[model samples]
Target: MANASSAATLSICSSSSSSFFSHIPTRVPSQFSFNHQKPKCRLLTIRAAVYTAPSPTPMPAASSSGIVLVDKSDSDKVNRLKSVYLEKIVPILKEEFGYNNIHEVPGIEKIVVNCGMGDAEQNSKGLEATIKDLSLITGQRPVKTRAKKSIASFKLREGTTVGIAVTLRGNVMYSFLDRLINLGFPRTRDFQGVNPNSFDGHGNYSIGMRDQSVFPEIRYEALGKTRGMDVCITTSANTDNEAQRLLALLGMPFKEGAGPTVLLRRKRKKAHHFDSKIKGKK
Candidate 1:
């Protein structure tokens, strides 16, 4: 049973539809007398066994890197506003992106994910604790986040087929958007949906933050120090086009740029007033 358990824990994260890699190395220019060193050949078969399941193929040249997927899991929103990288986000990337060399080795190496809470001091303590929590769970020093936003985001690298995160979410995301207008920032209101071109046909997507200052904490130079929050979400496709197709099938807004520009996508807030007597003598 111990042996069986070990093997089960080591299963590849594929859909069981595919898993095979092969290579035959042929010598190049062996006849040159001055070049006496024999060429080295490699034959390896590393299955689709990263934290997330990856598509099957020969290991890519070492030059390419993978992406890390993140999902914010902190809010009572029941999966909204929380910062986390789910086990499944990886498989989705594998199925969509064609990085045979990708991996899912786990660790929690970055950022807080809670949507609402205390001020900067409390936020700092919480973030440090959360980073420790991730490290403990994954059995290694956590990887750096691709983008950290609010307190509920942490992710891996880009374009490597790892799970980064899809967490520009929740009512808070909308709330933060609201503050943007009051602060006199230029932005499109009633944002019906993000551009689906952010992902590819297979189901992988990337979230690009147009302006990080939209978040109050990010812009707070003294009270809060923001992280670099730009991320590239890699899916199962080798390119962005395929990931966008998959997101479209999922009801994601692909070309909502389709509607007329005249109708703004928001409703104006009604004015409110409070009655109170002044303390100063008339």
Candidate 2:
């Protein structure tokens, strides 16, 4: 019985090995040569499987040095402002504010456009439409903002997309600002200048728009939803006065005499000793 089992195992092993070898493709000779001199000669020589790789195709040539490459230039607003600064603003600032160096003049750093989609939590499609509208207005894709913490009152959940924002800087920021000042603001309903008191003490100015339709990109009939947006312009100035001056020079229209100092003085004052003197005389 033991001899019979051993013979069966050997036969099974041989059959399995033969089956495995059968799956492998037969190798063909890699090299072949023919005698061109003797056209009638028949050749069946199987040379060693040496691989002779095909030559690689050559790469395309680069543009010539003489051809001028178009690169990003300073935005129209930036260029115009620079020229204005050199020709007018610098001298005016020097005469008025006693700023000795051109570097002392405040400059805009960045502008942030934020739009909150209140209906997004109820309908996700609203958020998408808001994103498209914002992208069209700013000429940049917005980053969707999500809720940081769950709120039971607002039905807001953590990680829920609630708003979209675009932060503009450098040339893009300047260009957007130019459009906002020249185009967008003019299209606004009331047509009043922006309030001068919107600047934070740290030289950052914030503007609130009632309707997104003021921007030319949004058509009144095509709007999926009416949304308000906040535009914050951050400046390199240390004080609100400096920032106000910088924005004003860049053609940001502010209400007449609504300067920072004037707004501070307009606050309600406490009853003075003049009232006590009048009471005493009475």
Which tens-of-lDDT digit does each residue in 24-91 have in candidate 1? 33444656537458889898988985596786743222211132322233223333212222333334
Against the true structure, candidate 1 has what lDDT?
A: 0.36
lDDT of 1 at 69: 24
Q: TM-score of every model?
A: 0.23, 0.62
Best by TM-score: 2
1-282, model 2: which lDDT tens digit per residue? 999999999999999999999998677455654546856778899989989899873322222421112123423334554455455555655666788887887777889999987667778788888888888988899998889999999888899988889998866776678779878999888777889888778999999998888888888899865789999999888898878877776678788757875344565656876788889999
The pairs that clash in candidate 2 are: none
- Regions more than 4 Å wrong, model 2: 1-88, 261-282
Where model 1 places Cα greater than 4 Å from the true spot, the runs are: 1-192, 196-204, 210-223, 226-228, 238-241, 257-282
